[model samples]
Target: MSGCCGPAPDGRYSEIFDERFASSIARRYRRRGLTAPEGRIIEALSGLGLHGRSVLEVGGGVGELQLELLARGAAETVNLELSDAYEQQADELMRASGVDGRVTRIVGVDLAAASDADVARADYVLLHRVICCYPDFAGLLGAAADHARSAVVFSHPARNLFTRAVVAMSNARMAIVGHDYRGFVHSPEAMLGVLRAHGLALRTYERSKRWHIAVAVREPAGVRTAPAG
Candidate 1:
């Protein structure tokens, strides 16, 4: 997710994501595919064709993932973003890929608070690197599950001592700068529980040194229940 800081709630995230990371992240995407953990996420979803399916990418950073999904046969894709700095660069990338019109970008909205009527449930929902960006893990995960017609996939910082230490340092910097933007290292089991409450079952799990990937699928009506650990 691209973070921002121009007078919006948690705008500091936008500032950090845009001014500090968007350009470099965009450049990396243009040269390669997604970064390691994100690449793993793409691999998981690529096998699932989007034919006539609606896809929503929450906190889509440079807008690369949505295009990839669209090109793979997704009917239409929507991006809910927090920052505008990535707008121009993302637009350029979309144009260059010839998928400029395939996406709908909504800026400055909190997807966690998004209503079902406001944002229709999608066949697939992605939150690549988004969890660490949000303060409320359960709300965000639950909302993503509710908004997903079939599956919801997300990337978050791996929960561990080292990761916690790093996040603590990052939060300290944000505080020192007087920014409300902060990072979190949430428990994977608790996050899974939130999705379970929303009727999604954990289906796939993968992890790297810094990031972890999890996919939750909306179960069949009669068989709706989370898998036992």
Candidate 2:
């Protein structure tokens, strides 16, 4: 929601992912842990041997996913956020989880528009439910792939009639409420095309009724085989 949510008068997009929103997400995470799609992402990344590797997560609200990855053996994680609203909740969660030293949250940084030098490269890049928030999926995914040394994993709304209609309704409601935030159902093929162009090949793809989990990895030299999931 970082790249998609428009800033308010105070220059923060606190209207959406406000303190209450962050606390709600944190409380839900503490009670229920990762969601289904989030679990699938962790399962995929686990197969890559997370021990000692680093992660970069975009729009990681409350830092739940990063905390889980850290528990699963990832060395360090960086979260690039657009709003400062989630910081307090993220900090409290980190402290409560005893992972205060491992996770780094950089607020107000938009990965889509950041330069190569502005962000650090990591072994894996994660974007869970983030693609739908950004209008320029290409720019966002391209930057994700560019920052990934091993794999780029993401989740997006499935391209189907029901999903498209739902997104349209959501956007309409946001407009009606005078919110600049909107949702999009970008073409999965086109999104994958953007990643593939950056030397990442589709490795594992999983689909649910509403979301698609796609994992694309950078293959070693001379490996021309494609992955089937």
Candidate 3:
């Protein structure tokens, strides 16, 4: 979606957000015994029963989760990214994984410019580490919920002493390095309020160190389950 905002004074953060963060962090989860975060995502999603469903991942960097969802039996995966550079990386990753045909990539120039059609086409939507970057947190959350027919899965930094310390350190380091601090820390309660206003019911939630993960199910009219035997 398109909106007017002051141009970023320096583009270093934008550049870093667009570029791939080397292979080290990616490999850490894949080969270095650091699968807990991925495991957390998998477990949360599995609980929602995503087999044969269409999934949309907003701001899915490099399309890692898109590949994983396709592999895990999601019928199709769509990636909506804000950066052309990252979108290219996502395309490359899909091609390298040999799943290009199963994924769709859309580069959104602005979040506010996204459409209802974009939001309404998915049975499931994921927002991993994306909301924290948005200046309008409520708008982003509402848009995500509006588009999801079934559920929205997300992970972000929690509000706590340790997390506050980390944010302070990050701000200090960014100042030292002539870069903008790119982190957004929100309280769990405030986030829940935004979801509730959009008619999404929280299904599951967890906290890991400074990170918080949550899955919220959309309460549409047609989503009722059959009665138990």
Candidate 4:
């Protein structure tokens, strides 16, 4: 979640995404990755047939999802991040899991800017808390579905008045501070439309007070779901 309060006095908005304090964030990531939200994500994944499959997690800032996917028998996982800040800490966590070689992290790239080779299709693709970070929902999500061989799972802000106020406040503060970081409140129906257009079928849906997760799997062999506008 975007901090309830704006960035700290120390330009933490920028530094938080840089190496300056990545270790601290990484530590927090390690702790929180094992919590309820992540649990729900894993629960949704239980039926994805992830065993020995490949995974790609966009905006997987701290590698938590990748680690968990590996633990659940994913053969390999790629982390597509928008910053290089987590390089050291992310690598360290992988080393700790003894799966360092199987995790490929492409830092400094977002889906809109990533190459086909950079994102090479995987059995499962994840976008936890990532949709709200990037402004281009269509481009980003379209790319996600294109890169997913079997299914795509993602979490985004729930469209509600409370979330609207929080995003508004956060954006206003960031604007005043001259920071480029901003969050979005996109339509779930439209998002489902994008997934549907990709020929993916909605398989499951889960939500928390602030976030919602949608898991869509590719249509069965020889079948295709009609795309929705």
Candidate 5:
């Protein structure tokens, strides 16, 4: 069961995703001018105590999180991106970071197509503002669970009255600007259900204005327990 936004036709979306977004992402992070929402995501993951662990960053736009994770002592960081342009930029950033050996950039691919063995190599998986774009939340969670040995952390727009209003306004604005809207809005309850069905237990979560962020641990099936002794 692949998601509606499964593979973006040709394993890449550079042609569709506005070049301005990529440029904006690079400029903001490079100049240390990330927006409040972006900064919050970085802070949230930083607080996850991820030292000496392997991390896989899905849809890692410009490799900002990967770079930060490496600086925070992650053993290795793998960035899976769906844009060749971003991948090239990420490679350049990794080279400039002097931590090239600690980072691997995989571009022009979707996470769903990755083999279970390849996905299972990570100790932690990060999906920042990426899940909402996925049409099949269930499949996405299942894939994340198969890969993550310990945890999968994600952040997305919260589906509240206020946030819904914001999204509507944003969509209208995008339409006025001649850009196609590309956000998938869902409530936190729906998000949690997806995780639960995939065998992930929520460990911590937080909500801010329109954003809902959570960290979940993977729970394997069929562990025998002694009778309440």
Candidate 6:
């Protein structure tokens, strides 16, 4: 999963995903492998053909999902992160897994605002637990779709009474702690619409108790080129 908090526009919220938080996340991955939601994402992407493909994961913490993709025969992966804290642990994990050469970590770059050169396109794009952290889902998902040549898969809190309450309480706690980070509950239908507007069609939708997993694939050439919206 991505870090617990969203990155501020100025990128000054590094403390939210600081070294301590990064380490804890890394340690958990080392001990427990992918989380349940993350496992679901991998399962969905695996069916889409990962062999020799490249992946770009936005806000990927410790690059665990990328590692899994590599193990499943991905050629390489680029991890874009807002906080630099995850780099150290991600590097250690990559090196320990003997895949350091196949991974690139780009830190402190907001994909929505990054230059084309900074945001490289890939065969598969992933955003595990990222949509909720970003308030502007359109900007984030648009950039993600622009960079994806084949597919985009993301997980977010399901829009419902239970998840809404969770987000509300989480935001309240952040406010109480003086954190600028916030959690959002964007509508799934609207989010999928963003992908369709970018020429990607929704292929799969799955849900657990709290999160919704969505997988969208790029439309074939000369087919579905116009935005339905």
Winning candidate number (lDDT): 6
Tens digit per residue, CA lDDT, model 6, 1-229: 2222223323434767788999999999999999989888888989999899999999888999999999999999988888778877997898899998888877777888776876779998999888888889999999999999999999988788887898899899998988888889998878999999888988989988877899999998767745435
Clashes of 5: 0
Each model's TM-score?
A: 0.91, 0.90, 0.80, 0.87, 0.79, 0.91
Model 4 regions more than 4 Å off: 1-16, 29-33, 226-229
The CA-based lDDT of model 5 is what?
0.70
Q: What range of 10 consecutive residues in model 1 has the weakest lDDT sum? A: 1-10
lDDT of each: 0.79, 0.84, 0.69, 0.78, 0.70, 0.85
Residue pairs in candidate 6 whose N, alpha carbon or C atoms collide under 3 angstroms: none
Superposed model 6: Cα runs more than 4 Å off: 1-12, 225-229
Query: How would you encode candidate 2's per-residue C-alpha lDDT over 84-150 as one tens digit per residue?
Result: 7888888888888898788877776678778776788999999998899889999999999999999
Clashes of 1: 8
Candidate 5 lDDT over 97-125, as tens digits, reads: 87778877665556766676444458888
Off by over 4 Å in 3: 1-13, 20-34, 117-120, 172-181, 220-229
Model 3, 68-93: lDDT tens per residue? Answer: 77777888887766655554455556
Tell me the number of clashing residue pairs for each predicted model: 8, 0, 6, 0, 0, 0
| TM-score computed on alpha carbons, candidate 2 | 0.90
> What CA RMSD would candidate 5 show?
5.8
Give the per-residue Cα lDDT of candidate 2 at 173. Answer: 89
RMSD of each: 3.2, 4.0, 5.9, 6.1, 5.8, 3.9
Judging by lDDT, tell me the better candidate of 5 and 6.
Answer: 6
Once model 3 is optimally superposed onto the true structure by TM-score, how far is the C-alpha of residue 84 displaced, in angstroms? 2.8
